[model samples]
Target: MIKKRVLCFSAILSIMVLSKLQSRPQGISIENPYKQIMLEHAARLKEEAKSPRNNSKAYFSSLTFAEASVPTEDVKVKSKLSQYLAKFSFKKVRSHEMHNRADKYLPKIAKILKSYGIPEDFKYIPIVESGLDPRVSSHKGAGGYWQFMPTTARLYGLKVNGNVDERKDFIKSTHAAARYLKSLYEEFGDWTLVAAAYNVGGGSLKSSIRNQKKDDYYKLRLNGETASYVYKIISVKEVIENPRMYGYKI
Candidate 1:
């Protein structure tokens, strides 16, 4: 009788367990909230994948700025990009010397940028800054391929003096630029903001962000030059990478 009682209790317990399991949904756990969230996310992604907008070429052709991909859907960015593309087109441009210089120096600059873990897209900065001319100097006294001012050059370990200015050295200046860019990225946490700070100075850009309560480089109200700086870089990248697309023989 005792054995029979024990067996009957065991059978009842098994039925209860089986009933609970059968009532619950398949392939889902009630205890794991993270798994449920992931399952929902996967379902959402599957639906998005079916959307035609996600499959468009324009969506895929987004340009990368310092490893951050930006869609080309913004009207301001598109307008600025179009202007530069037309300007850099073979028929509109006077000389291909810029392209030639880029071919010569980009390999070394790219290697230095890579060594510092910077994006290769930053190699185009020298092209826009000084037209890849090592001897070029701005009216404000910034010089070299990377265009470091005297004070900034000194700050980055480049010796900038009357007789021996290391800012004119492409190799050294490129390294200095990389260091400066890396520091800016660390502070701002955004490559686009880094480029803006590089143009307008960190203090000024920070002030703008604080006052306007806007951190986005594209949306921020910056000076004319700072506003167009990143777009110019993107345009340069597009033309350089797709020379044939822009009708350039080089």
Candidate 2:
């Protein structure tokens, strides 16, 4: 009777070990079937969650621009600019003709901006403003990449006459732009605001600054065009330095 009882106990223990081994994978040695099953279930659930959801209601339907959420302060303007940069690609104007033109103009602009302690990035202002085409004149009488109106040009010491519009002279106009930029920086103490004020006048920018109670360009309420102006300059700077990164082949 004692031998039979011992035999039964040994057989039951062997069955329990076999059952545990069967519940595990071929290469694994999991002792708990419940834990192994739970881990497999979790993995499958993760894959399901990663699968694309086709329901349109799950995401935003309307088109939204980055600036929509930005506050009306100069700093916010810079921050929003960093966000806006991801959406658009840049184009490199590397045509032989354009490069030739840029060669003639970029040096002088760089020299003047350097003299003023402005960033080397300022050299591209003409690329956006005038495409290095001195003969190019805006309908509003703003000319050159530094794009100065007759009144502003004169204020910056660039002569605008019928025979000789100094606005078309790269060297003279850039000098004027440097002087004007320096003055704007002096008044606002911020490069972002100075860049914006270049598009609009300093007086208008200062009024906006005071009314907004913050120096942040992004946080301040501004006209749509002017709001984008400073960011456009930053975008231009980024693209010019590494056009390929912005997806411009040139």
Candidate 3:
């Protein structure tokens, strides 16, 4: 009697599980939330892939900033960029807000950057730095539109004292940022490396280059953030410049 009861309970449990499985949608499971999210994302992407405006070639080609190009052709770089592209693959309400704020300044910033002899694309630095937010301050003592550290601000001829912080002054700080980025470009002779220096500090990048005997930004054994710094900027540039290509409505 005990054996019969146990067998019957096992049979009933198996039947319920089989029924649940049969009732579940084809090739979809409720077990893993992460997988479910990815599947949903893939479905969205499949829909977007049908759009004729989706241009992967043009998007990949724009990865080159100044004379230096991201090695998006490399398997690792391609994979990494795909990861960022996925992360950036979102509706652009936030980006539209930033872009609306950016419009008033980007033309001026572009002119300033051009006059300063830096690539106009470099103007995106401040976008990545503070999203055109003149009031943003980092925990690392960086502040203002360009996100200058107090010392770096002063070094670039911006006043950052208690009485008045010129780092918060849009025009002054943009000029300072242009000067600083130019100086870094002069030091590195590569805009990509200059960008890395801008993010991770010239000293650290210099040391990495010296020790590694490899000036290539992609080759250096950098801190994780620094390693992917230029890639982040490139990713932002890709999305911002071609929102439609990335499936962003804004």
| Top of the candidates by lDDT | 1
Off by over 4 Å in 1: 1-61
User: If scored against the real structure, what TM-score would every candidate get?
Assistant: 0.74, 0.61, 0.75
lDDT of 2 by residue, 171-228 (tens): 7888899998888878987776777787778898889888888777766788987887
- Tens digits of lDDT, candidate 1, 152-240: 88999999776898888888888999999999989998888988898888899999999999999878999999988888788777777
Candidate 2's C-alpha lDDT? 0.67
At residue 163, candidate 1 shows an lDDT of 87
- Pick the TM-score winner: 3
Off by over 4 Å in 2: 1-104
Candidate 3 local lDDT, 1-250, one digit each (tens) = 9999999999999999999978876554455776888999999999877753355555565577665667766777877777766555446456766656667888888898888999877877887788888888888889999999999999999998889999889889989999999999889988888988999999989999999999888778899888877777777776767667666562
Candidate 3: minimum summed lDDT over ten consecutive residues — where?
51-60
Of the candidates numbered 1 and 3, which has the greater lDDT value? 1
In order, what lDDT does every prediction score? 0.82, 0.67, 0.80
| lDDT agreement of model 1 with the native | 0.82
